[model samples]
Target: MKTADPPRPRTRPKRPGAPGAHRRRALPYLLIAPTMLALSAVLGYPLVKLVLLSFQDMTRKELFAGTDPPWVGFKQYRSIFTDAFFWEVVGRTALFTVVCVGLTMGVAMGVALLMRQVDPWVRVTMAGVLVAVWAMPIMVAAAVFRWLTDTDYGVVNWALGLLPGADFTGHNWFANPWHGFTVIVLVVVWGAVPFATITLHAALTQVPAELEEAARVDGARGWQLFRCVTFPVIKPAFVMVTALMAIWDFGVFNQIWLMRGGQPEKEYYLLGVYSFTESFAVNRYSSGAAIAVITVLLLLVGAVVYLRQLLRMGEVE
Candidate 1:
């Protein structure tokens, strides 16, 4: 047999670090480097500038003239802490966020449930209407609402006047702080409901009809069925919506600014509006920066709490 074919030799596989292996290993990082660099340029740089501005006595003059700003440390922060108006604004912002988000999500969930119970054609129509409402620009909607709540020729007052023993005709909706606040709340809730409803409806669709049927067979009806079966399945969506709405409503500016910019004793001033007024109106750039920092901190606290709850929920699951 010719000496067993001269004893064939075996070849080993290539090591991971050999030639193209190193490039392949580094490819993923290389791909992500641009995104990280862009984020640093867009977000990180601005954030650093904001922090630096907060610690300095930055004014309109210095900002425009390119002069070196004086460092003031925590003086702006101390002024904000000492000011009762700032605390009031904080409290008002908190209350407005809670109420607006609560009403928006509550009504949205209710509407989504109702949509499921309706005929297919009606459901489609309702969904279309909600989408149309959501598509409207915030400023346009605010302006329309402002006009609708007008004292002399508003449709709202005209409609309310029709109610028995009720008089809303010639009513100035923004005449008082509480009244203006209520109108703002209604406007925000109207704009917010469509998004929440659509998200909730999508989440509801993923839930198995069989699970619902099983729960119903076990005498779980209405809220009981929802609480026991539906909720557990869609909890993630609910928590996500809540967190998103909280953050959004907390920093609402355009709607309130357009409808009524901190009118009636500035009772309607949210953190965003307050910061804008401080910086742009009064030229207190440093103070405004401090307020913006505080607002972010508060939002971070809320986010932390939400994350903790989500983690606990995951553990339970």
Candidate 2:
């Protein structure tokens, strides 16, 4: 009887208030707030400014004195399309990226595979050399290459002198555009090889001994072992290395520019240097901004293509 009397006053439990629901919804915003703030401070502000600048046809005069920036929608974009220099820059950049990345990654993979048979200490020593090369600052490395490529007293030319009727020595690398381009590409390859080596070496370690043994057990030769077993496992690393190297090659301004002594020639005028000249040297803010936007778009497209290659091999296991 007593228990029945107590049960007569039963009521439904109360749900959380609107403020609690609001706080629950706000959790994601709270978590993302720092990232949003950081982006606004670092990337967001500059991007917004660049976009604003791109749409306008304002001169340096208009920019510096805080006047209302004049809008001339897509004039700069149209000009970029028409500019012969822009096309030259694009071509040079593209060529440099392709050659440097190809040479770097190819050699790196070959060397890594060769080293796989060597002792662990030798592998460590080789890795040390590559890491040493990588750790050297870009400017310092460029300077070393410049001296080694000197027209009058270069080691490369000296090495070339061993060949009869070869006048590769005393050739003006910076003076002749192709020579300059070649030397710059060589330096780029040299710089990028270490990254490829390190990445591929790490990847090669994860490749099972059993797989290679199985391939060999099937009467596979060196090439066959790589073709059937090794290559498939390291494909991801190869793609990633190539993409990053391509981006680095494209944005290579300091190396080529410094090597060529900032020459305004067919060979030295890659997109990065061109953009730099436009922005800082020529004081063409809008033009420079336009170049930057284009460069970013190119990089985005390249990255997408690179990532797609890796994604296409989905779930290799």
Candidate 3:
């Protein structure tokens, strides 16, 4: 009976910390907590403040007096919605986005095709040029464009003067709203083309050559080969680039601002410039915040619709 009672239960071996001890499951979260806090401080707080401010009447006095901002409900939104100038800006923004995105994507596709066809050395040179153009800072690009289009001594006017029976000397590009818009479009396209071209070229390089050769064997050449063989392979990349270009073009402020500070009767004011002027210039903080919110919502809706359509088409393909 004593020998049988001495057969006790076996004890488990001890872990590094202690017997049957477990590691802290929150360690990973602890590691990322600092980064999460930083992002919240930088991006989240401002976004929340903007939304809150949009619902309140934030005048210069209220901003400086340290009093509670008066809540205005939808009045600010109603005013903006009813304004004809706001509608005009919306139309202009839409048109600008469509034209710039379409032209940039088309030109980039052509450039990508040319890159595929050219000699290695020529391709390298072209790539270098594109990189240089892309690396130009936006402010620098704006300054350079201003010099190029200067009414008095611009190289553009100088070049135009050489045309037979044509003279653009002293013709102010920024004086006319449409001319200014065209110039802005050109500058934006120049900066944007390099990105689109490089992305499309990278996509093209991933396409299998066998498929292209097969299409060629079946009497497809030139655009036919591209349409049948190359396009489907690169359609996803193309759609992505087109969507991104649309977003960038829609939110373009600095380029327009730097070019002429939204001059020519403020006709060149896109939503971004309009919002900036409304907030900082006129000190209508709530109205500007509303405008910004609306702009974001419009863009979000457009992006969602466009991406859905593109995805459905991709699935069908």
Q: Clashes in each model (backbone N, CA, C under 3 Å)?
A: 0, 0, 0
Candidate No. with top TM-score:
1
Clash pairs (backbone) in predicted model 3: none
* Candidate 3 ranges beyond 4 A from true positions: 1-41, 261-264, 313-317
Per-residue lDDT over 23-139 for candidate 2, one digit per residue giving the tens place of the 0 to 100 score: 988999999999999989999889888888888876778868989778889998999999987898898789878888889988999888867879989988998898999888878
* Residue 301 displacement in candidate 3 (angstroms): 1.1
* TM-scores of all predicted structures: 0.88, 0.85, 0.86
Count backbone overlaps in model 2. 0
Better of 1 and 2 by TM-score: 1
Which should have the higher TM-score, number 2 or number 3?
A: 3
Q: Of 1 and 2, which scores higher on lDDT?
A: 1
lDDT value for model 3: 0.90
| Candidate numbers, best TM-score first, in rank order | 1, 3, 2
